[model samples]
Target chain A: MAKGGVAAERRRPHSHLREATVGYAFILPALVGIVALYLFPLIKTAYLSFTKTGVFGDSTFIGGANYANLVTDPTFGTALRSSAIYTVIVLLAIPISIVIAALIAQVRHGATLYRIAYFLPVVTLPVAVGMVWRFIYNGDFGLLNALLSLIGIDGKAWVADPTVAIFAVSAVGIWTSLGTAIIILGAGLQGIPQDLYEAASLDGAGPLRQFRSITLPLLTPSIFFVSVLSVIGSLQMFDLIYVMIGRNNPALSQSQTIVYLFYQKAFVEGNRGYGAAIAIALLLIIMALTAIQFRLQKRWVFYG
Target chain B: MGNTQPRHHQIIIHAVLGIGAVIMVAPFIWQILTTFKTVTESRAVPPTILPAVWSIAAYERFFTSVPLWSLLGMSLGVLVVRVGGQLVLCSLAAYGFARFRFPGRGLLFGVFLVMLMAPSQLFLISQFDLMKSLHLLDTLPAIAIPGMFSAFGTFLMRQAFIAIPKEFEEAARLDGANSWQLFWRILLPMTGPTLAALGVLTSLYSWNDLLWPLIVASNKHMTLPVGLSLLQGQYGTDYPTLMAGSLIASLPLIIVFVILQRQFFAGIASSGLKG
Candidate 1:
């Protein structure tokens, strides 16, 4: 890298160097961000996972102690279980979104209305979503209970009961994500050429028949994509749980997602080493899932 | 176009979709209704469809209880720096990667991709530590810094930049336009959609971000979401006030989204497609 303008450098020396310098200058700001946020932390998290911190806030190399401790830690276990449950449950969004996207695609009128309605929750702040849902789940005066009362069915404290809390949170998770999946799948639906359906129709294929033959196979890529992203996003779920099932809630223990546990251990409990270990474990799980997804994509995701 | 569904089928589709749409926006509708209800009416067992007395009592309580003004200010502050920084820096980097044949370009861009794929949790603990060491804990910048640039934005801008024909760059260069001038005046202007999409996405993310600000900032530097979360925690059973606060915090983004629905949808589509 040189320190002159292109004209000056052409008349002088190191013109190639000056060009490289300018190129580097252009990327320097973003490079600083990647390093500061990603690269540095990645290596640090890996290292800290293997260490323990003293009372003085200094870390000692106690290899695998944090990892071994996590194996027996009950809260970690609960968080892991809840997170897995959430991931599995939210995967339902894929099929739901597909149906909605298909339905929206067929409509010639009021399509944007449906899109806006479905997508509104996705844009609303999660804290707000959590709060409103919490209020809706109130045992005595909640909306859910009120709605159930009309049918003579009883509704329990949806977010208050330990047994039902994670499911409650999972519902919100699925709700927030439907909009993104619908948008993506809707785009995928549009990309399925109109003539494919028209051609199928000329061949006497009914709507259901045409859908199975033309729409399903072509939209598999988006389906596969939305599922993978949904799972990844679901595993990292925090805000809704944090707001809806706060510390004082009886269901907090049962509803703790892995990331919630990570925040608690690292910051609230001052167990950075264990928290780092949990984070690494989550990273590994995500990688394994992605690998599994790619392997499975071959079976269904039509690249064409 | 040849196949409009049968009449009965269209009726059924609309019926199902209509119900689903209602379910989707039900909470928001409730939030708005609850915001204006009296405390007693808001909690009615049968639930009043509308408040017998539409009131701003909850708003008064919320404004008095929470630092709504400052929270909004901090969130806006974070959003501005984050979105502005990402657009400028990401486009510059993307432009460089698009145009330059520098050594390590492949390696560095690969690194950016890795960062792009790595989720936020991987970086949280360390980012917090970095902020601590710099004595920046509980600062607005602490909330805003990590998101000031993003791998997603860079990659998106890079793709947009690469799609620009090479002849334009050669033409600009023949005019003796420097790299800055080329990016600022010529090439940058051409990337309007990409820039707009990234800006909208960045602002939305920054505004709704909870975990980072929840961890990093306390009362003084608290962003809107974090503040709202705390409001929920402290005012646990106060549905009216909570809904009121939530509506106020969410209104700005909702308004912006309504105005820039195209950009919002485009931004969301790009992100999901990139996956």
Candidate 2:
């Protein structure tokens, strides 16, 4: 590129070449860092998944063994199920946030106050959020139990129960994500035409009818975007579970997401090759899901 | 547009928003209340919303035990340095892409866009290796250096700059203003909202960041998030202390959001939609 730019400048003697060369020079550092650090590792992960590396460095060729094991691994099956559940649950919350955004958009009084309250969790550091929420879920004196006790309800160890742990974690995911979803949905709602509502009313459509006919169709693009992002993010869920549920937590074995399993194999266990396989598998899942969403968007997402 | 139906709709609107507000504010209220309670008080059978005896014991203990001040300093230090560098460099690159007709421009900017799609997890190992090789393993710069350039910021800024009327830049060019002067005098001033949104977003990310700082800063440069995590470990099962630390760590973000709430949403929506 530098050669091409310099060569073109010599022939044409144009100011555009000088300007472009300078632009490239300024962007060079970030480009170099990203290529070396991000893209290289991504490619390397893909390559390493194909080979058999005993340690992080020592290597041998054993094509498809790790991936074949990944196919039948019971843990992988469980993790996949858990990841799917988390994604579905989190995706469900998007509509709830959209409804909330719609309601907030209609109200003139203290709308910013509602936004701030919701966004507080979004802005809080994930580590801190994890810690605080972990304490709230504690079995004995945890706030959830205490709150339940008020109504004579027994709140078991929410995050320790295998049946409920993933859901518990999903609840936090829903909470933290509410702010971004609300803000995005609110922006989408504002893009909707005011005349649509007025016209619907003149035609004798009720409020709910107006929203169903007017708002829902127009908001589909943002809704689709939020769903796509939520799925991608939920599949990669790790930080909160890692922090809230201890490494030794019994629920960890039952509720592990694929990315959490990948972190375990790659970072903690130092089975870098197997971990790389899991990472690559997870990448394939993301790519497939994203491709499908883009394909399906034609059926649903409205541009306006 | 008549008053009756519009007024009736207003009642439903408030009721709905009111419920949403309660749900959103509940957990934070719980967190704040827990911070003030004693370990025993927090664990009481009928969980107390407000402490029976109000005390600063938890807050006092957190400050004394953890290097809360140093962690705060680290968060601020990384935020100030990285945000300053990123604002300058990202805006420059954004303007270059938006205005200048340069050779290989499409290919160069394509790299930035591609990098935007790549998640931070992909770079964890290589970035660690880079920092280790540079002998910056346990330093603040390890975190700040990677954060100094953001693809999203550059992409958003370029869009903002492109939205500026080309005639403004052309007028500056007609007056013999150089490229730098055009960017500084004409372009920068015109994109105030974009810059505000970028600044707030960048600062918030840097301030609340955990993953990279966790990987990069060994012990010496422990930021607030990392420090708070360690606090959770050390004070095993101590809710009050953890709550207090979490509260303190959250204060900066809350203050920043309150002051710049409008810009934060604007920035997030624009960047999310575009990127």
Candidate 3:
């Protein structure tokens, strides 16, 4: 109860250490937790990536050998390419989210219905969503094919065909993520005041004109946020690929994301060294892209 | 009046929303529909929209095949631990950062911000090794451990604590309340909404968490989603059974969402805004 200890321990100069002790004690658990789980692991993985690891988890440092192997690894190329394609496709959801969020923000009626309908996918188990979508994308006797037949078009093996597999899985990825993007954008939309629109309309501006000026400019921050999140999320895409295109599938090679490839090498093949290398590779790509986005944001991301 | 134009615009809005909603809702509707259909009907060339005979056969198979009760219990057990850990650890760390002026405060928090930025994949291999060393592999606790360390949750709660009016703490200090008392009684109680928000978000995440649990837990220790994934692998073509399993896996949260719709939406909105 040292009342005067506020503002950097003005009470007693000796009590600063005591005050800091209390602070350290308070943060000790979380600090220890992250140090153990996140920070230490990050360092350990980096160390392990350079080693030639054995199945027994023992390792000998081999200095860039794993990275060398990663360079030559053909599957790495496919994984990186698939990950990039998925991120690009999923980024489309932000524009889609903007329109939907704008519409939802405007309408007073059935807002709850629209929100809940979209949010269902967000809450559902990805494994389940992946399973159901795989069935729907089945070559024969699938709901998608059946619907296509109604429109007099035939459907191919969506998750099984190597050429179509990544796109098919990307579609599912986009579908599940729509709710999250919309929720963020919806909140962002709400922060844009109603009076701006009313004033714009009073000035005889069309709804589109008001949106182009007032809505879009103000919504840039949310759009940027969603894009960063989407890029990160899409790059880590694994659950749908694992569920929809199983480990044994011929299409697995074409559709696997970086995380999936990491899982394969680290877990399945017991090549922890290679997996660590892949993980580090993904981290570099993500850091580079996120940095670029942040750099680019000044040009477009409006604060007000 | 522009009222006529507004009414006309409303029709197109509803139509677009309605169409999108159908696309959004169809897979789930189909999952529910196909759950009741016989194998014959589910695999029919032109798929039937609704089941000719409504049946719980899929449910029966899913129940009888998987160790449903154990996995569900494991899911809940892990959920409670993970959520509890977030509330306690994040609150403590946030309180410390918000209220204190320690020597390494900024640097330590910078460490946390770095952790938050890196993807979960970066830590997986080493975390797996750590689990092995600790002999926690294939255990429900392993599924719960890495999740407990949440840089994101800490940052969120810290921001919440910072946003609290400083008057409460000053008043509490005047009453000779110590730091712990100030934290538990005066500060923590006021952060109820943020606490609830963190709890809800963490619960959703932990409940639906797949990859970590999928990696660590092999059998009886598998959480709900991991178990559901295995069920899919085993019953690949059995849409009915898979749908039933998937529905069961997702049911608890869906029910919670339906009941606490406002809070969940509020939680999502705030998490989106702050997060």
Q: How does chain B score by TM in each prediction? A: 0.94, 0.95, 0.94
Model 1 Cα lDDT, one tens digit per residue, A1-304: 3556656757654756667788999999899988988899989988989998532368999998898998998988999999999999989888999999999988868898898889888778889989999999888999989999999999999998999999988988889889889988998888888888788888888888987888999999888888888888888989989988898888999999999999888888888888899999999899899999999898878978
Error of 2 at A167 (Å): 0.7
lDDT of each: 0.88, 0.81, 0.87
- Top of the candidates by DockQ: 1
Measured over the true interface residues after superposition, the C-alpha RMSD of each candidate is 1.8, 2.5, 2.2
In the order shown, the candidates' DockQ scores are 0.66, 0.51, 0.65
Tens-place lDDT per residue, model 3, A174-244, is 89889989988888887888788777878998988888999999989888888888888888888888899
Deviation in Å, model 3, residue B54 alpha carbon: 1.8
Considering just the first chain, candidate 1 attains a TM-score of 0.93
Model 2 achieves a DockQ score of 0.51
lDDT for model 2, please: 0.81
Full candidate order by lDDT, most accurate first: 1, 3, 2
True contacts kept of each: 0.69, 0.51, 0.71
Which has the better TM-score: candidate 2, or candidate 3? 3
- DockQ for candidate 1: 0.66
Q: Which stretches of candidate 3 lie over 4 Å from their true place?
A: A1-10, B1-5, B273-275
> Candidate 3 on B1-275: residue-level lDDT in tens?
12324676888888888888899999999999999998778899877888989998988998899999998999999989999999999999999998888898999999999998898988988788889889999997789988887998999889889999999888888999999999998888888888888888888889987888888897658899888888877887899999999998898998888787777777777766222
lDDT of 1 by residue, B1-275 (tens): 24566688878889999999999988899999999998888888799988898999999999999988899999999999999899988999999898877789899999999888776888988998898888898888898888887888999999999999989989989999988899899999999998998998888888888999988897578999989988877777878999999999988998888778888888887776231
